[model samples]
Target chain A: MTNTLTDYISGYMDTINQQLEQFVYSLQVPERLRDSMLYSIQAGGKRIRPILLLMACEAYGGSPNRALPVGCAVEMVHTYSLIHDDLPAMDNDDVRRGMPTNHKKFDDATAILAGDGLLTASFFAITNHDLLQDEEKVYLSRELSKASGAEGMVAGQMLDMEAENQELTVEKLEQIHKHKTGELLRFSAVAGAYIGGANQSQLQSIEKYARHLGLLFQVQDDILDIIGDEEEMGKPVGSDETNQKSTYPQLLGLQGAIDKRDYYANQAKEALKEAGVDSTLLEEFIDYIQHRKK
Target chain B: MTNTLTDYISGYMDTINQQLEQFVYSLQVPERLRDSMLYSIQAGGKRIRPILLLMACEAYGGSPNRALPVGCAVEMVHTYSLIHDDLPAMDNDDVRRGMPTNHKKFDDATAILAGDGLLTASFFAITNHDLLQDEEKVYLSRELSKASGAEGMVAGQMLDMEAENQELTVEKLEQIHKHKTGELLRFSAVAGAYIGGANQSQLQSIEKYARHLGLLFQVQDDILDIIGDEEEMGKPVGSDETNQKSTYPQLLGLQGAIDKRDYYANQAKEALKEAGVDSTLLEEFIDYIQHRKK
Candidate 1:
């Protein structure tokens, strides 16, 4: 099942990568800025956000190709956030995805503009997806915006920045994670279901699944940041500790964080069962999220 | 004619301002960021881009209300650019429109996120506009994307940044200005006319008019940067000089820049005549672009 999930995800990513190249090729970005956006986005990663959206759509009986635009859009939003996060003004990271971060390769201005360009372009990609009906296209575009904007990812980022060096209660930390990482992840599943024309009950199930999956995903990240090897993660470990950011590991002890991750992963699996999604791919997804080394 | 244009433009602005306020209110941006976005956006500048769109639609025999979304969209895109341009990595300006810039009022990260949220939200707003048919809405969204993306505003900005302190010819300067300031302006007229369901020939005429009007608008802006009073302009005088950026007044003599503005204005007026648009509002627009003081 794990192998099957890997094969399915890799296939979807290849297709998505091709489409991304085509979409970006149509734009005549300055060579410098273009290279910067391409460097960060094109550097290989798991492509989990887009894959989740595709899988969610397929689970709802929609063609993955039909949901490709939303897939691309979620990835674009994720990429833009990563680019901005790596900027000196933000997280100030020097490496990402085993390569120099965008700001490291390009000047600060080009990196900033590249992030801006990618962020703006996500809507263009979603709205321009030719397969969806006009109304459906509009709906998905709005959903995508809601996921990325002030009430969502941006708000989450603000909380993360503010919470640095300050002790945060569990509730405050959960709210921050929910917005920062969970909103986009939730949107990935929900938008896929929406674009795939899932009914209300099915959507609710997918939403439930996505919510816990997101929490589990972040908790795993917290664990990895604290103890994972730098080579496997492709960056220095313990930077989170050095930065004094609030994390599951910090809020809960290491063992407590692992326990919470298991609870959320179990909840995620239960939600999928409630949704009646029959794919073995989903079970494999649960296993992968919980046990991945990187 | 200029007085007539001012009246027409201001009336359109008054209506659009209400919609702009509603959009900002709907964002539920954190109170601080909301204030930051609203501060510069609501600050009193002529709503030239949006009003131009409405006038063009009106000239093409469409209802001005039908163009409202497009009007507001261009303004949103314009406002986003302003917000980002004032960031510490870019112009690093402390003020705009007689108030502290978004970054100055809020922190740099919030300002960046606000600009990004606004940028992404523009397409969402265009897609969600209730007035247009599904097809028209799709087309309008596509056009806005083309105008705002890397080949348009983003690319234009890159060129502008790269040209600073470099010897830029008139042609390079025109290319930069066209993408930076003119693409959105051109899209305003073109999009409004398209929404009005203009025939192909009429669309062509409006496109020509928009092209000339957009360049004329920039030429006048360049002129004002050199000679306009700081009180009226709401920024320091000779900012282009202060920034060591290239501009029309630098490439051409002051008289030459003035002559070029008049030439483009005349061409704009001629295009409207060729389109056989009976809009007195559009006729006056040419005059305003040619000689307005602020």
Candidate 2:
């Protein structure tokens, strides 16, 4: 079952990655900028956001192919954020995905524009997809903007910068991560539900699941930053601490962090239960986040 | 009459600027990122893009206020490009709108994030607006995305980057500027028409006008870069020459550039005439662009 799930998810990811590359290429990006964008995207993260989006769509009885555009859109938004985050002004990290960051590989301006390009491309993807209704497309596009913009990831990033060198409570940390990272996750699930024609109540349930799943995803990330090997993680470890940034492992002890992860994981499963839909794949994803080493 | 037109455009801009500031603030932008975005937006340009969009809408008998969100959206996208363009990797300019650029004022990372935030917020603004039918909103959103994304402004920018220090002919320069700078201008007009429920022929006429207007806009900009006063322009003159960037004035002599501006300006007015709409405001604006100092 685990292997089958992996195969299913991987197959979906491959389709998404392929279609996404084609979309990016169709933009006719100049050689240099194109190279920079491809550098980060092709650097090989797990395509976690896209996978979640596709899974949510599938769970709601939508074809993964139909959902592929949204999957690509979410990942584009995610990759764009990562490019900007790795800039000299933000995380200022020299490496990501075990390769030189976009800014490091290209110039900062190109990296900045590449991020802008990706973010802008995401809107086009969601809006241009022919299979979705106008209302569905508009709603998804709106939700995406809410997730990626100031009130969402950008605001969270601002808070993260300010909170650096200062201690933060668990609640504050959650607030930061929820916006910086969680909002997009919520958008992915809710958008999938929307495009799949899920009812309002069903969407609400998916939101609950996404909310918890997003929190757990970040927590696991924090844990990995501490415990995972640098080679496997593909970026420097303990840099979060080195930068004086707050994290779950910092607020909660190692054991406390694990407990929190379990708490959220259970909450996610409960939300799925409320959804009253078969979300076995989503459940497995939650479990995977809790257990993944890298 | 000129004063009345100026008042009309300026009043509309003042409303948009106020609304833009408010809309951005509504997102809970982190203090740092918020400061960066506000600094660029409030730094003050001519507000030409918004004014053009408003005039187009008004020309078609659409309420300017109803079109205000689209105005703000284009300006946000424009401001984002300027922010990213000033980064060390791109144009490396130290100033814009008479103020230090975002990267200089904040940091490279903050500037990049601010640009990212602003770009995402553009679409968010359009989607969240109350005016327009659901179908219209979706169409509007898609058009704006195409204008801003890889196929449009991004490609233009990529071309700009590639052409630097290379031998670019007048035709290539026009092609690059058409997408890089003109596409959004075209969008501003098209968006207004879309909001106004323009018929196909009306839209085509506006498209023709916009293409010519954009060409004239760029030629004038290039002319200003060479001959305009530093104090009047609010940035150092001749930076384009210093950077060895290609422009109309570079490819064509000064006299030729001026002639091109006039030719395109006349063509734009003619297109407006062909549209059979009230051309009073648009005509005045076109004349203003032909002779304006900044």
The residue ranges of model 1 lying beyond 4 angstroms of the native Cα positions read none
Collision count of model 2: 2
DockQ of each: 0.65, 0.74
Query: What is the C-alpha lDDT profile of model 1 across B145-193, one tens digit per residue?
Result: 7788877898888888888889889999989988998899889988888
Per-candidate TM-score, chain A: 0.96, 0.97
Tens-digit lDDT string for candidate 1 (A1-294)? 367898898788789898776777677888887887777678867888888888888877888878887787788788888888777877888888678888888877888888888877777787678788888777777777787887789778777877889999878988888888999989998888887778889889888888898888888999999888889888888888899888888888999999999999999889888786665776678778888767
The superposed Cα distance between candidate 2 and the true structure at residue B209, in angstroms, equals 1.3
Q: Which pairs in model 1 have colliding backbones?
A: none
Distance (Å) between predicted and true CA of B259, model 2?
1.3
TM-score of 1: 0.96
Worst 10 residues of 2 chain A by lDDT: A1-10
For residue B79, model 1's alpha carbon misses the true position, in angstroms, by 0.8
lDDT scores of the candidates, listed in order: 0.82, 0.85
